[model samples]
Target chain A: MTHEAKTVSEQTRERLLDAAREAFSQHGFQGATVREICRRAEANVAAVNYHFGNKDGLLAEALNFAPLKAMQLANAKADGNPEVRLRLFIRDFMLMLLDETNGSLPCRIMARELADPTPALDKIVREAIAPLHDFLGKLLREIAGGKTGEAELRRCMHSILGQCLYYRHSHPVLQRLHPKLRYDHKKIETIAEHIADFSLAGIGYISGKTCA
Target chain B: MTHEAKTVSEQTRERLLDAAREAFSQHGFQGATVREICRRAEANVAAVNYHFGNKDGLLAEALNFAPLKAMQLANAKADGNPEVRLRLFIRDFMLMLLDETNGSLPCRIMARELADPTPALDKIVREAIAPLHDFLGKLLREIAGGKTGEAELRRCMHSILGQCLYYRHSHPVLQRLHPKLRYDHKKIETIAEHIADFSLAGIGYISGKTCA
Candidate 1:
């Protein structure tokens, strides 16, 4: 009976989170009301407050889910070699990014939060993303033999991400620029592989510093 | 005196644009009202409507200015070789992105628009980016002997822009990951270089033929 109660609670929590992600992604944090999330979840108004304490808490709860899932996937791709692990990390991240929606409202909401990140952003970073960063950093450090400057490694990693994420974020502009290729599956596939190849060139340069 | 009148009109237009850019960067399209923009510009609401029509029109106008200007700058560096022109474009784009922000609010807003473009996004792309595309496409065709697939080139170019833009967009997330490097100038510089180097490698893969 105790186990049944726990399972029910878990299911409720998951439902709330899914609803919150959709709500926050569409309306953004400031615009997304707790009442709306409750309505979407078909739960009580106080339920979100009970489960997450506030809108910010709910947003954090939803946002943290992806990073945690992504990190787990990324970490599992860790081969014996740090370089290989880092490469896998990049690939996994790109794939995760591609799996996102057309408008990428979730990532956009997250981007907005970063600009004026509330305290909630910190919690997500601490709990979900920090582990991924550490994993990537350690892998990069091993590849660099601790010789690459921290700033350089951060820049290289961020560039790799930026390249991968560009298509999702700038779909609107790219759509206009290349109208014929907006939803072309072949185009997206080419972009993914192309970005991966280029990012490797830049990241490998940083690792090469160990020899220099 | 005709030239003098043109100068004054240009100056006012520039001021309105500057104000729009500032407001849009800080508050985003949804959050920023025309009153705020007018107040920031020290111009009247009527002035905004006269120059750019509705709020959406104003946003389109604001988005149009930078990329067009950027293309002009990049085209100046064009040396008949598409590869060289592309490298120049990436380098110039990165420099402009770096110069345009401090804490990256602009980067955040731009990233959001890319992720989830709307009607306003259309004007920016159609009026502004279309020319840039034509210019780039012709250059690429020249290099590829008019043989590369349209989708392949689009992906490569998008990847280049993404690498440049992502570094600033994710700066805050990165800061939290490496707490000690928050807002570090050296870090931004390093990212610019990394993006340039990496994207160059990706663009370098343009052998002109549709392959794999």
Candidate 2:
């Protein structure tokens, strides 16, 4: 096709993805309909089939969309000390997980996946989560000074990530438990610092190192 | 009514609750149907109304069922050393969260609620989660020797609970990441020990105590 045609097709694809994410987030995969997604995207009914091959295809694309983008942003700077890197990683991760400006579509969709997993979950874990896990594990190993056992290191990684994820996954419960607690930008920073410090101490205690 | 009739009615209610928990766990609140739930329970169509009032009421009851039951088990013995209490708490909590024999209905339903919260969540948090939080918070305070600040104490609680809950909330991801890892009785014990030890060190480090 011509350049203008290609650009229009690309725009339509992006719009469909945006609409798909919102629908999937709200209604889940089995509950969301292609016609409604098309209506929300303002695209022709055939657009989804033509661009994504089918609704499942669209769902896969939408599920893969946000984390890859966030990954790019998270992996952008890795030059700091492991401690600083851990803090930055926690801050960026909390920000990504708690971001509401984009309607939290990523987190909402992910929460849905956790609740009712589809075949797409394996791909997500392999492509998005596994890399992030590796990144965190490496940083953790650096901080632990390479003496921690594989199992302990893995558990420590889970501890750090579990702390970060609780804010997003149990957000409704958190708000109710602490009525004043909000994930405003400032609160996110505070949470990031707290997780980082607690994790560093936990690691230090495990790895026989004093947290400097 | 008569005593025998009351006994039959109570049996029907128990059946409905079991069916409701299974349906809501699989399909979420909005996706689960009263008809399907009745069918599963092998009860009269109007039994849900007579038992729990409506679908929303059923959802509320089903959502509140497991955690409260688990709380009783967790709180059954609280007279031990604070450290032993923490280990037992983590063990029981993990067991409740990872119990596959019950089809993991409690954790699955809880995950669904987290993904798509209804009005029932506030009740769950207040009636079930808040008391548990207070219980853990008080235990954490004892471990910290009453020296940790309130905010720090709360974060520490989140950190500890987050570690335990992550194994449930992120089970699919965890499975994919470590396909060989399984939550048998022994594995749960190991995880409990790790989290208890890690958390004790964290609390100790933060509260200026040496983990004995």
Candidate 3:
């Protein structure tokens, strides 16, 4: 295709992905309708089929697009102490979840997918999540004195990530239990600091080092 | 009014609740049909309306019933050292999630509700989850030497509970990450011990107590 044709096709693909992400996050995969997605994207009825082949294909692309973009942003600036790096990773993660313009669409979609997985999960794990997992694993190993077993490392990693992700995926339950807990930046910073301190302490304790 | 009539009514209600809980857990509130529930319960169509007023009422009751029963089971034999008690709490919570016969219905339903809450959430939190939260908070406080401030206590509690809950709500993701991590009794015990040790160390660290 010509350059102008390629640009138009790329723009339409982006629009479709944006619309599909919003729809899937709000209504979940099975509940989201292709017609509504097309309407929101202002694309032709056949656009999803032509560009992405189907709704599932569109969903896979959408889910991958949002988190990969956020992960790229979070992985930027890789020069700091492990603690500072951990803090920045968490702060960026929280910002991605609580972004006003997007409003946690990536997180919401991920949680939904985790709850009831689809064909997209395999690609998500390989492309979007596995690298992040490896990155966090390395940071955790360094924080734990660099000598823990793989199983031990995984458990520790889960402890840290579980804390961060719990706040996002379980927001409704947390709010129900604690009505005053806010989800704004200030609260997220506090949460990040607490998680970092708690995790560092846990790591220190596990690694036989003094935390404070 | 009549003694036999009361027994019969109770039996029917029990049957309806069991059937509705299974249906709702599998298909969610909107996707589950009253007809399917009635068919499973072996009850007439009017029986649900008669016993529970409507589908929503039946669902609320069903949701309440499952968790309350599990909570009661978990709360049994609560006399032990705080650490022992915490281990039991985590173990029982895992058991409830991995219950083979019921297959995590309570968890699935609860997750669905948290993802897209309805009016039932208010009652579920107040009636089912609040007591458990209070129970866990007390256990954590005792483990932390009973001197941490409320906010600190809450963050600690979230850390522990988040760890336990992550294994449940994110099982698919975890399984995808580590195909060898089983969810049987032995594996659950190891997880419980790890969480208890990790949490006690974290609490001690937070409270300025030397954990090791």
Candidate 4:
């Protein structure tokens, strides 16, 4: 294919991803229809098959694209201060969960997958979650400032992530339970800072170090 | 009705609740059929309407039963030591999550509700979860033992619950990530200790107290 043809194909694929993300978020995987996605994307029916092979392929890609991009952005700006890095990592994670444009599809999809896992779960875990875990794990180790066993390290990491993830996963229940809780970006910043402070204190006590 | 007739009716209701719990856990709210639950309970169709009024009523009751039992057990053994009480609370909550016989139906149902909420969620949160939150919030307050506001108390409570809950809500993802992580009673004890220690350290640091 010529350069112009290649550019057009790439644009079509991107449009399909955008449309699929919206449709899948609102209607879910099985509930979302390819015809509507194609119509919304302004692409031909053959475009999905040609680009992604099937709905499952598009589902995986659509679910992964934005969060992965957020991860990349977080990674690029990652720096030396473990505390600063932890806060930034959490802020980016909260952004991924509360991304306005995607309407939190990545997180909602992940929750659905957790309830009734799909084949796509493996790919998402390996591609997105595992790497994120490793990244956060290393940062905790630095802030901890001493030798910690695998189990202890993992427990600390889960505590931090669990706090961040709980807000998104339990947003509805939380809203009902505490009507004042909000998920806007400003509120998310406060939450991120709270989680960082709570996690660092726990880590400090565990590692026998004092952290600010 | 005679006393004997009332006993039989109570037995039937319990049996139906058991069946509905299993059905809803396996197949979800809409996917679980009244017929299948009846078949499993060895009761006739009219028995459901006669006892519970409808499937929605059965679902709310079934989802509430086991966790309520777990809470009752924990509450009976509750004492003044905030640390011990916290440990017991985490252990009992873990048991409620990993109870093999009930197959974690309450957690799964709650997850589904989080993903796609229904009217049942309101009742579940208000009736079941709010009390638990209040109970946990009090425990954290005791641990903090200072001028902690509602928000700080809640963040601590969530951090503790989040650690205990992570093992259940993300069981599949976690199992995939850590092959050796088990949920046996003995392991639950260790996990409860870890969470209690981690959480206490955080609370201590926040309260400006020295914690071991």
Candidate 5:
């Protein structure tokens, strides 16, 4: 309850989250076990129960940190022309997605959950992800030029996010097909720019045309 | 066998595929059961085993239909301009995603499968998916002036495909957030245009700039 206790508890929770990010991303939720998470965290198995209560709860809590923090950063860096700001946001978002501190597990797990969502999905959307959705939709609306519809906008963001995340999520298989595509700074930036430009151009045309 | 017998067998197999598509798409591979598929198809459980060998086999066969057939239709009408043909391909691909004959279940199943790809992935990729991927990647290459790196071209194709498919795959969540968004024909076409333009511009810019 005291400030010191809160800080200590928070650090412990952060460690658990760090471990969850790695485990869930690698093995997936159903495949990830609590014992393994505890081992990675170097904390008591009861610590997870004590901190977040269950595996699903921990997973949900863990996913919240990176995207939420990134969305905050993306919104904060709103600058230049509408197009420029949107580009920066896309860049930041892709960078956030690759936050190895959190890893690509959140994306993999969140995506899997979307296909066959569980109850924890409500918490993820409500707490961690909805703000990013709102932020993007609002940005799209401002730049939309009155030509965009809600569905088109959603699809637009979905497209951008999907393209951004696909390389990392599919890295294993992509490398299987070709050995050269490494996940590093230059490649990530190239892909990020492509997605933003492609997405924004689509938005520009859609907004100009009045149907998207 | 006689031609008539082969035709009848094909129809029976089609009926089984319809059932598997719905079941697998709705419940995912592990989540879906053979009994439920038979119940839906109005065929005996024995028919499923007889037709596809098992649940996994049924899923693979089911995924092979619809999209490939529709993609063939798109490719058949391919034109001198790969970009223009690509625009059409994106349109048909969206329609395939909306293949109401199977409902949204196939979308869900495929999304989940991609999230946690199974042993079934290679077959799904080889029989049903690789051609489309290869086709799209080649279009990107032509658009990129055919000078892009192999890994870069593959990544580019992956990005475009991810964006297009992610719209349908993530529709449920996006719809809830925007309540205003709908996946109707007009809207789908609009988003497709946006994706095509966005991707085209990005590919052009990166290929030109990076290659130069």
Candidate 6:
């Protein structure tokens, strides 16, 4: 194929991926259709099959389209006090989960996966969640001064994460309960601060450092 | 209708509801079919309409089948210390979420609603979640010695709840991350304790008690 043809083909593939991400985020893997994705992408009906082999192939690619590099960036900035690191980490993680302008496609897709898991969940766990878990575990271990038991550390880590994810998973219920609770940048910052302070104190207490 | 015929009709209605709860829990409201529900209940295909009016009506009833009376019971047992009440509340809440023998139908159905919500969400929020939220809020306020701001107290309540609900929402991912992790009776108790301790410290810190 000529250079121009190849470029056109690549553009079509990219459009298909973009359309797939939006469709999958909205309708999930099972609910989304190749015809709809193709229509949204303005590509030929066969474009999905031609580019990604099948719908499953497209889903796999779409699920990984947005890498969670923010987590890695947050971890790399682990230079200062552990408390500061923890706070920054919660802020960044919450932003990823709550921010819309940052394109909440990944989080929404993951929520769909959680609601009705497909075979893609295994890869998602290995690629995205496990790394996040390990990163938080290391940070919590440092904050706890290595004195807390492994199981306790894991629970603490989960407590912190649960606090973060609750905002996302239960967004609808929360809105009803607190009609004015918006996840704007300011509110996100406040929530991040709350989780950070709450978690730091929790860790300190469990490690027998604060209460002692 | 004769007494014996009315008794048989009531039994059929009960069976249909049982089938609906199971189907809605497993397949969600949208995914579950009246035909399938009737098949499971060994009733006529038209029974869903005759008994419950429609699929939506059936969904509404099935959603309310289990009344979350455990939370009410737990709250009523709140007699002595605020901290102990909070711990017992967390324990009861987590048991309701994680206990399989307790029939996780309500939790699973709620999870489905969160994933792909219908109009029934409003009722759920009002009937089930709001009461739970209010109960936890009052407990947190007492624990914080009435010094914590309402906003802060709400976040604290969310933190504790987030910790408990995480075990349910992220069960699949958690299992993948820690293969040995189980939500058995003993493990649930341990987790309940961890969340209670962690959250108490968080509340104490945020309310300016523990750190000072």
Most lDDT-accurate candidate: 6
Give the CA lDDT, 0 to 100, for residue A54 in model 3.
90
Check candidate 2 and list the clashing pairs. Answer: none
User: Candidate 4 lDDT, tens digit per residue, B52-146?
Assistant: 89988888778754565567456646787878887777777777677575466776566556645665988878766787787777777777775
Residue-by-residue lDDT tens digits, candidate 6, A1-212: 56445687788998998899899877778778899999999998888988988888888888762446666565667776878888888887788778876675776688667646577888888887787778788878888976778888888998998898888888877777768867889889999999999999999889894325
What lDDT score goes with residue B126 in model 3?
Answer: 76
Candidate ordering by TM-score (highest first): 6, 2, 4, 3, 5, 1
Q: Write the per-residue lDDT of candidate 4 for residues A1-212, one digit (tens) a residue.
A: 66445687789999999898788765556557899999999999888999999989888777754565566566657786778888788777777676564365676667556645566888778877787788778778777765777678887888887777777667778888778866777877777777777778788777773232
What is the C-alpha lDDT profile of model 2 across B1-212, one tens digit per residue?
A: 66445687788898999999888876778778899989999998899998888888887776655564565455656666888888888887787778776454755676557645676887777776777788888888888986568888898899998888888778877877788978888888888888887888888777873233
Candidate closer to the true structure by DockQ (higher is better), 3 or 4: 4
Clashes of each: 2, 0, 0, 0, 6, 0
The local lDDT score (0 to 100) that residue A117 gets in candidate 3 is: 61
Off by over 4 Å in 4: A1-16, A26-54, A65-77, A101-104, A209-212, B1-14, B30-39, B42-54, B65-77, B101-108, B209-212
Q: Give the Cα error of residue A112 in candidate 1, in Å.
A: 6.3
Please give, for residues B26-104, the per-residue lDDT of candidate 3 as tens digits.
6677677899999998899999999989987898778754664566455555776887787778777766665555455
DockQ of each: 0.48, 0.56, 0.52, 0.52, 0.40, 0.70
For the second chain of model 6, what is the TM-score against the true structure's chain B?
A: 0.86
Model 5 over residues B45-147: C-alpha lDDT tens digits?
Answer: 7988888777777876676546455666657567878888878877777666754543545444555576567767766556555666776777677778766
List the candidate 5 regions with Cα displacement exceeding 4 Å. Answer: A1-19, A33-55, A74-82, A99-108, A141-155, A207-212, B1-16, B41-54, B65-70, B73-77, B102-111, B144-155, B179-182, B201-212
Q: What is the lDDT of residue A127 in candidate 2?
A: 71
Candidate 5 chain B worst ten-residue window by lDDT: B99-108
Q: Each candidate: fraction of true contacts kept?
A: 0.70, 0.56, 0.47, 0.47, 0.42, 0.76
For residue A61, what is the lDDT in candidate 2?
81
> Per-prediction interface RMSD?
2.7, 1.8, 1.7, 1.8, 2.7, 1.5
Candidate 1 C-alpha lDDT tens digits along A96-161: 555454433445455446544566787767765576566666766676567678867766666666
Cα-based TM-score, every candidate: 0.75, 0.84, 0.81, 0.82, 0.78, 0.89
Global local distance difference test of model 6: 0.81
Predicted candidate 5 versus true structure: per-residue lDDT over A1-212, tens digit per residue: 66445687788788899898788767667667898988998888899999987777787687744655665675666574767777777766666555454345666567556545666777767765697777777777877756677866765677677787675455545654665755566656776777776666666665656652
